[model samples]
Target: MTIRLTVNRERWWNHVVGVADEVDGLIPVVKGNGYGFGRAGLAIAASKLSPLLAVGTVHEIVGLPDEVTPVVLTPTWRPPDTTEPVLTVGSNDHIAALRGWQGRVIVKLSSGMQRYGGNIDLVAAAQRAGLRTVGVAIHPPLAGTDDDHRQQIVDHLPDIDPSLDVWVSHLFPSTYESLPDSHRYKLRLGTYLWHGDREALHLEADVIDTREVRPGDRAGYHLTEVPGAGTLVMIGAGTANGVAPLSDGRSPFHHRRQRMALLESPHMHTSMGFVPAGDPCPRPGDWVDLQRPLIHTAVDELRWI
Candidate 1:
């Protein structure tokens, strides 16, 4: 039983390089399962583009190569276990927590997202506390247009110290370019950087078992009667593998380019899908495409073709 992510190596690399060329000071975000490529793999990939990388938390700062410098995106109340990665401080309390510590820190300014950040004064507070202030981070909300995101960053620039580099998220290249060129700006990108070329990545799960079922025959965990006469195909991905029903209650499994129906909710390591009698039914050794967002799915194997 296997779940795989097959990459069109040439196209994927080309896209990565192109994005790097297009965006100046690109800091690839290698956090949260590395946007489906796993954190370690992405850290190495990020090193090729830029020396800096961003992780969600200090806990995710492990196993990275020496060439890559990690910047923690989330502000923490306690000191990080290591001093190599740059920390983010959003509040005076966050700054106070690092008192007497000699490490670099980024001041997170509050944006429309209102997720994590403090007033622009936190930058001076951090500097007063004798911490090495590296940059200012602005994470825009996803609810607005690119112009809205750009405006949010622009709103804070006059107050932020001109010497500090500004790290921003969720802005297009054109929007990024529109920012005042007097200050250095680094674009912290994840989804747009890795998954931009959707056609270059493919996700699939292997069919592990198959059984012909008749209508009204009991099946699945609840032992509910089979909905129709079809082939019950067991796939190798389940909740343990990050395979779950979509928010809309639609099945994520597909065979022969057609969506397959789930016999029941996914189990720990497998999901039972149904294919009507006239439809294309996969055999035990066949592979089926999964219509899941790569960010949310975990695969057992990665194949770069």
Candidate 2:
């Protein structure tokens, strides 16, 4: 069965170009289903708009065509053959290991993100190795830190390298835009383009089949029972297709919207759930929201047409 997804293609392309222009030269991130637009579609779009290509890892490099300079956010395990890369330095030791290697590279400095990057000392080592250091980098915290992350980096940046060719990182647009033009080097954007700039993107899946359930009938795993006399509509797509809707209380990303509960009947790999908002909500062969509206949901299945 096929679950149809509506593509806001014009809005997407316009956003990509708009976002890229917001910064000096955008590094279009084309990793992992191109953040929902499909890698090929994103790569082609990014190639046309961005000065450099942004990708999650080395594996994603295969799809990009020539003329696009690719930047791999992954630490330097191997430099891909497609394009010369500014290898991401995640640790001080990795910088040491990269010492004596002559190539274009970016030092990934870690902060509240606490994920990937090197530090000030790593910069000195790179200079010593004769590596053409084009950028100072930091992947910002997911919480979107209140100036702490960038401030910390800015405090240390002068001491690291005052002549950085590029200062690459991700940040909320407010933060990114506030960056003094002199200090801001490059912006790596993903969510803003493939997804929406704000809490506006929507994802929907097709309703497949609906069944009437008696008040006490058992359903799915653990012998869960149907609570009322209502219709259970089977969505065309399920968890196997990455349509499993979910939420947790710890963060605002989840608390703001509703997610479909999991269903186990048919012993499925993908997921489809009985809509809590049934009848008036969705009809079989009709499209229904599979993810929280306005909240950034991870990409599951995406096909751009």
- Tell me, by lDDT, which candidate is best: 1
**Per-prediction TM-score:** 0.97, 0.80
Q: What are the per-residue Cα lDDT tens digits for candidate 2 across 1-305?
A: 44334566666667767776677656767777565556786688778886688877778777587878778777765555533655677676666666666667787766766666656677766667776777777666656564765675566556555567545455655666676545546767777655754323456655666766777876665667765656565665544444434444221111125443444432333333544434344556766555433223334555444
| Worst window of 10 by summed lDDT in candidate 1 | 75-84
Best by TM-score: 1
lDDT of 2: 0.60
- With a 3 Å backbone cut-off (N, CA, C), the pairs that clash in candidate 2 are 90-117, 108-117, 108-118, 238-270, 238-271, 239-270, 239-271, 240-270
lDDT of 1 by residue, 1-305 (tens): 78899999999989989999999989999888787888888889899998998899988888888998889888777776667889999889899999987889999999987777988889889999999999999999999899999999999989887799999999988789889977899999899999999999999999999999998898889997788898899999999878998899989988888999998999999999988888889999999999888888887899999
